[model samples]
Target: MAPPTTTNSWQHPSPHLTRVDAFRRQVNRRYGLSLETYHELLRWSVTELEAFCRELWTFCGVVCSAPPERVAGPDDGALDRMWPRPNWFPGARLNFTENMLAAGLAAHPDAVAVSACREGGAAWRHLTWARLRDETARYAAALRSLGVGQGDRVAVVTTNSVEALLVLLACGSVGAIMSSTASDMGAKGILERYLQIRPKVLFVESRVVYNGKTHDHREKLGGVVAQLRKAVAELEVVIDVSGSSWSDGRIKSLDNFLDVRTESLRFAQVPFDHPIYILYSSGTTGPPKCIVHGGGSALLQQKKDFILGFDLGPDSTYYQYTTTGWMMWNYLISALSLGARIVLYDGSPLYPSPDYQVQLLQEQGVTHYGTSPKFLAALKQAGIKNMPPLDSLQMTLSTGAPLSAEIFEWFRSIFPSKVGLVSATGGTDLVAGIIGGSPLLPVHHGELPAPSLGMAVEIWDANGKNIEDTGEKGDLVITKPFFSMPITFWGEGGEEKYRKAYFDTFPGVWHHGDFVRKIVKTQGYEVLGRSDGVLNPGGVRFGAAELYGIVDQFSEVQDCIAVGQRRKLDADEQVLLFLKVKTPPLSDGLRDRIRTTIRKQLSSRHVPAHILEVQDIPYTMNGKRIENLVKDVVCGRTAKVGGTAANPESLEEYEKFVDLPLVQSSAKL
Candidate 1:
């Protein structure tokens, strides 16, 4: 396939004045190299990682007590372990929270650090840098009073508010690992994640409001507390952020829990690879994997992404619509390191109305607005044609799923031309993107602008051969260990589990499980959905995104999912397309148009064997489609609905197709 012609929609007026270009010039001068362009600088970064990382650390002005003796440790002479997991910044000692607050406290103590809003609220509340630091200090003192120290786990069940940020900062300051999930998660889901880490202290919200509805979690909290106390012998206390009048003796209000003293805020300096956060997998298929991330690594990688990838600064207002459960929420908090004001919204993006959300973005003067494809699709379906001119809005980011070309083009038509629409692909496993947009690159129609700096990204076929330049779809693999790679998995056999998850298929490469294609001409990447969910028919494999890209162009289709179904007697897997129409009923004419459009745009093998309209499509709690789970049910396998599924009942609609009869004859359109 040929790459689409690129257009220069957004570019720096003066190349030398851009932030990345300036960084490149500085690196060239320091290293005595003649790198000319941004692409050349990226090549240098991946090839000469030691010098690049050392320069980046100094450029970001990381607050460290002591610098590393060397960038990376010497190779241990193990072939399989050489590139898979390289030790970075050995003998360095720093605290994540200290680095985050250093710039803000020193330069902008009175500036607004966080702006937040609750569901259906009319006003936004601001938290200044001084207040953030003071509150975090108080929380740290409180945790210390409870004997929370290094390597301990502190779990939170809360909303996206200032309180969540405070808890994360406090835990990171004391070297305690922080993990949190949104209030909407069921008790089972919450336990499945927290139980693995066995947190010593738990933070809970008494109540949460979403879509203009208040949900009381008192009874659910009681059950969880009882179960956790029995399961984890180390559990000591539970803190309530809402100050609810609960009768439980173990629960304490926020005011009572804080043990304010005359001591100043102290940061516990730990090793470079010390665990600071424990992020969980989606847990749609089975139990969620507890992946631990290093403090120094997460800080450096996220700062690089925010500073260079998004061009965030002290004056920039960063807003990412995320709950505590998603990795994007963690990424959003990293903006504090740059002293950028972060916006937190705790509600459905489509609540009240799509226009209401748009108005909030414009009114907040959001410079970097992070969002998802579903939100954009909803806005397009609602016929929202006009929006207020957002002069401050520079970029709009989309993740969690693939963004179709139809919606991308539609969004481009409605949004300001200067605002670059960036579609990035990453996961909880890496804590950052492998391929994303850059401030210096031009935005393509439906492709990520470039691979992230310092990441050796490649597309490999089934035989572990690079196929990126050939324009063929294959597994997304990182050829070298990156800064944000998980330190380890929790519990017994942690090393084995970590190795099996990413390094089992390829001996030393990190298989990210995403099926992707690179456009050779444009040098952009297209993430076709997950590799495990790839559909195979007549020995040709393709991702579900290819089918959805074609069918989404129709105005009548609201949303859809494509899966592969193969029973015991079938020789080849059959492609099944399920649609949730905007109207009550889908007409036969629309089905024919869908089939014909797919066959014309893609190949005949891409056409679905059956096109059926359904009431709804299943998605994970993080808003990712459950294609692999649906495929299991349609292939005569028992699908165990997990806590991560947002709407598990939607899977029952596809169970009837398990015994579907094979087509007697191929019908020609």
Candidate 2:
């Protein structure tokens, strides 16, 4: 837990470049080779993963109908046929919303493909790409006149706008699977994730706005459509996006669930591992694990992390503050498959104040924003120095948690030095990013500027060897199998819950429970967060994101979590920390300057025996940081708190830290 030094602060020079050096000089002139660095085209994209996915499916023009004669097939005979599962694009039929409405109507059928707004600053709305493909072809002809189709399952619940991206492009243009969540979850976490995907069409959201309050989910959508029509007997229709007069016999309304003479929009080609979306698993400490995801491997791994990791094309706009229950809103609507407009705010990126999402990312010029790390530590504790220069902001990203090298040097001291502040860390079981950001490398303040092209990702240890060139700190795994992995995990022992959630710790590799490292003087990758919430204490392991990057550089901390408790006759693990304080009763010289700034920036075995203030810091409805449900309510256990928890009453203030006195300490170092 000690590798931080490496500081180029930010680089990207080479004959001045960006579309990842025009996709590494179009993979060095279409693979003649001699790839000069994005770490040698990410080590020739994880060792020639089928010629780097057939040159990333012909450099993302991917509107496949039957293209793959084979871009990776082998394995599947198992008995460790070298970690099996490799069949991406074997006879691919495609149609993830017809390659995102044929790349947004062949790149800009009158531009603006979905702009949106809604929480307190309303009137923005837009849509365009021929009105989002004629409102997803009248919601895919009203879900095929309510018979739904091709592997069904719809869902929704809503709110991330433009009618939840036209119900996920009308359930991926009828190959159907969708599953969404936000509209602030609960009706028992939207019937524990649409009663495990029995969803034959739900949609919902009769009112939701946020931080400036609105929320009238018509009595929680009539008790979640009467307990999902008595536990999903294949539900068969609900709709209601906004115009909910509560009629029950299978409800209706967004203009009687639109069919508008079904104005053309076909696309159901199907099979490249069909399914489509679903994505759950933050069931805090129970249920939730739906996962699924496929549609040509979530459209060729979110169009290769949005055209070579965030250089997103066709005049990129993006935005991503997320929540149609977060997989970054399914990686921000795959930025309309790269005809990129996106934006969709919906609510509270600190609603009416706190720089209202940096004035809506400088009045929506937003060239690829996506945020988190507690919104750059609440804009560096609201001192908010200067950020409105924006100038078509390039890349910012940051994922649900762990971004801190003091919030990437306070977001490079208030933005735009040619943006690129990335910091990703994949999750919702590989929706994307197994480590991220690359616009041809070198951003290094708190790492992660690599390991994502075809992600073989590494750093192992704790017996499963490969500790990524010994910069030590381990587990993040992956080892191979790319193209967005989750085509499983729904119910009925889903292949033993997808090999016990990622190959039961390394047998066939993909472990990814986080705790990474690989800095080796800046090859760049640092995560250090959830290796099952790492911590340990006396036995000294680390990463509650390295004590919330030294208690979030305290401007009297407005949030913090850090866990590891151990109780019931504990022999070690103590470390608690809590703190939710933007001014609270936490004094004692600000808890001895947050334990002397975690013993002077991470050491005294990473401090914390118990610092406690807590007024709220549970998080998960995609803003992550529940630290193993506050370390299972400080080790006394019984935690359960799930409904996607954006504060399940902040887990009852960590159950009073299981009767404190540092969990009945037996005085020892």
Most TM-score-accurate candidate? 1
Q: What is the C-alpha lDDT profile of model 2 across 391-448, one tens digit per residue?
A: 8877788887778788888777667666668788888787777778776666777778
Residue-pair clashes per candidate: 0, 1
lDDT of each residue in 261-348, candidate 1, tens digit only: 7357899999777888999887987778899999998899989888777788888899998999999999999988998889999888
Per-residue lDDT value at 359 in model 1: 81
The numbered model that scores best in lDDT is 1
lDDT of all the models against the reference?
0.85, 0.78
TM-score of candidate 1 on Cα atoms, chains taken together: 0.96
